[model samples]
Target: MAPSATAVPATAVPATGTLLRLATAGSVDDGKSTLVGRLLHDTKSVLSDQLAAVERVSRERGLTAADLALLTDGLRAEREQGITIDVAYRYFATARRSFVLADCPGHVQYTRNTVTGSSTADVVVLLVDARKGVLEQTRRHLAVTALLRVPHVVVAVNKIDLVDFSQEVFERVNAEVQQVARELGVEEATAIPVSALDGDNVAERSTRTSWYAGPTLLELLEEIPPSDDPAHEAFRMPVQLVIRPQGAARDEAHRDYRGYAGQVASGVVRLGDEVVVLPSGTRSTVTGIDLGERSLDEAFAPQSVTLRLADEVDISRGDVIAAAADAPVPTQDLEAVVCWLGDAPLRPGQRYLLKHGSRTVQTAVRTINGSLDLDDLHAVPSEALSLNDIGLVSLRLASPVPVEDYATSRRGGSFLLIDAHDGRTVAAGMVGATLPTAADAPTTPEGDEAWDI
Candidate 1:
């Protein structure tokens, strides 16, 4: 399959199967690194030199077999500590499909890393030690996946070989995983038993598990749909830079050139499409879309393009250019779901810098409605939220921002909470805007006190 017609031809994109992004997440020591290494080794993605180094290192460590974890544990600190501290990315592919894998840390302290890795992942390969069916960390990871709305989840019951490859054990563990995944709004969850160390049922089917009838891990990877198609959705592009080349030496044809350069965040934009430069509400028609030296009739999400407008409009970085018919409303007040990443609890009236797309503004936590309990995926009325806590929050912005619901527009509806003082990322937010209805969020009365913000 050629690149989508709406996509820019100047870029080299996959043609057969759309690129898939996945992340490995599990409790510490759940063999996530090993599982990832097995996938690479079995698929012949690992180079001979790398495999030899792994072998030499394993022998030096007095291990009879190679330690595949060496392939992913890159940092010296991670290797010494035997825990992944940073998110490691790896690229590999089978003839059927291409993949970008994110090996996220499993510790509770690194929950933020998981968030960063899975934020853009198409599928989250959540590993579970067959011996330890579902840990608290598993619940937390599942909650994060739900909060982020990750498209697909594969529960790999790793280390099945350690349990004699028992079908009963696998079934018991699989049941628990499916129940939790479903409760957390994951529509489809697939659980498979595998031994990452032995390469059983990872890239290929394991003959030992005769009772199990399912697609191998590699087969599943090749099977899932890439994700939401940005080309078919509503058009949106947050201007990064306003280009004006007329000031410098230029060709006669480009002397009066002025354009807005930005990556298309969502949807498709075509020449002659009516667009509104947001916050300023300047309306104009798209005159041209250029990618380097090539002129394209249309462009879609994830592609960088310089757009020319028919009218001279006041536009700058942080301004959103959107389809006029589907323009978003700018508001000073925003209701959101926040995953607090800071060590300090998120308290009401606390000030921070809110970054939405390329726009940044002074903002404060006006109120914290409640926090979600990962154990049961329920809401707990709370005055403040601590690290790794998911909560409902309302924010007051110094300036109004044009935003949409996360379900409606993933790119426009997401934001980052940056600490004003030292520039640390405090939280990740998804715009809810409106309070949840009864059907969506069941009302549970707090003890003797009804607090309404």
Candidate 2:
């Protein structure tokens, strides 16, 4: 194989740049694994030993070229069956950006894996076979991306070589994808045509077709910005631990210090800022912020800092320290959208443990309002949610908790439902309905978006 026009050198050091979290989703045999492998290979991120192993295995199978898909499909079952059963994460870097890419399984049974991989992704790369066009699974993945509020969605029309690299097929598939994405309320949707197997328009432009003009897949990935900046959102922190040194072994300087330790989930915090504790509604002012041994005047989102408040309010592991003026109201009745992942059906009146942020509480499903219909992207009445079913439900919690709307804050609103009898995670839930209702309409951030199809 000839070197790609834009291939990076193996010896080139990875540049320090913005990190992008990306995930791949599509139907089986759509070349997701192959595409991931291509990116890793062209970027020179794969080790020489791994490449040699792939070459050896390809020869044993009597193949002409090394199987690049083997680079990411690390599971034994996946290698034998030629299907991705679990989410495989690969890290690689280019001159412009660093990436944490998750290659999600395409099989319908592994839709739960797709949801889990896409939950916190900055962007989701959805693949569609140029020959198959758009399928039911395509719509399902689009719905999942929309429901999780993934910032961006990229539709890769893989196997363009099989379709003769026709622009007509690419446009048709892209049009259908755009329509479905718009219906599902997915904001940033981009479509690009490429052959993942042949490395055409992947890391570099292919010379096979002179009719098409667009940035390569790698170029797009390097250009797309991260979904959100944690520092810009409202202040929220779930107390993970209370730092109180006791006993005579403690130093005098640390003897009187009492601090709340946790990662700042969103927004910023500074000394003298008024904060309120949830469940108890106690008010306090920040006196100091400690990051490890050093003290700072302020702290921002995603930073693990110990906070010293002026008041001696009763706070614990499950409590939340939020901005006083923007604190979320504590409530026991929660309206949410849940993606049922359990093998057993999810029915109303069933009890489970709800884990939100740093707190867990017993909760019962009060009602199953409706389940989403992937056909037309609408909510239809349903009595129970089966495996891989996405639905809207009402939950009754045993105690009050500070949960925000998922549309506004992803970290503050997302939660998991666990089976009490066993320790299995039954469902992944969001605090508000992801689909449109009587009161809400499908919407996205206001801006003129661009596409490189």
TM-score of each: 0.91, 0.93
Per-residue lDDT tens digits for candidate 1, residues 1-453, read 011122212123243467899998888899999888887777666776777788898899999888888888999998888778899898777778888899999999888899999989999999999998999898888878877878999999999999999999999999999888777777888999999998888988889999889988889999998888777778999999998775455678887889999999999999999999988898999999999989999999889999999998999889999999989988888888888899999887778999999999888777778777766666767788898888888788888788889878677899999998999998999898322221245322333222221
Pairs in clash, predicted candidate 2: none
Runs with alpha carbons beyond 4 Å of true place in candidate 1 = 1-16, 250-252, 433-453
On TM-score, the candidate that comes out on top is: 2
User: Model 2, residue 4: displacement in angstroms?
Assistant: 9.8
Name the regions of candidate 2 deviating beyond 4 angstroms. 2-15, 436-453
Write model 2 residue lDDT over 268-311, tens digit each, in one string.
99999999999789999999999988999999989999999998
lDDT of 2 at 280: 86
Tell me the lDDT of model 1 at 104. Answer: 94
At residue 7, candidate 1 shows an lDDT of: 20
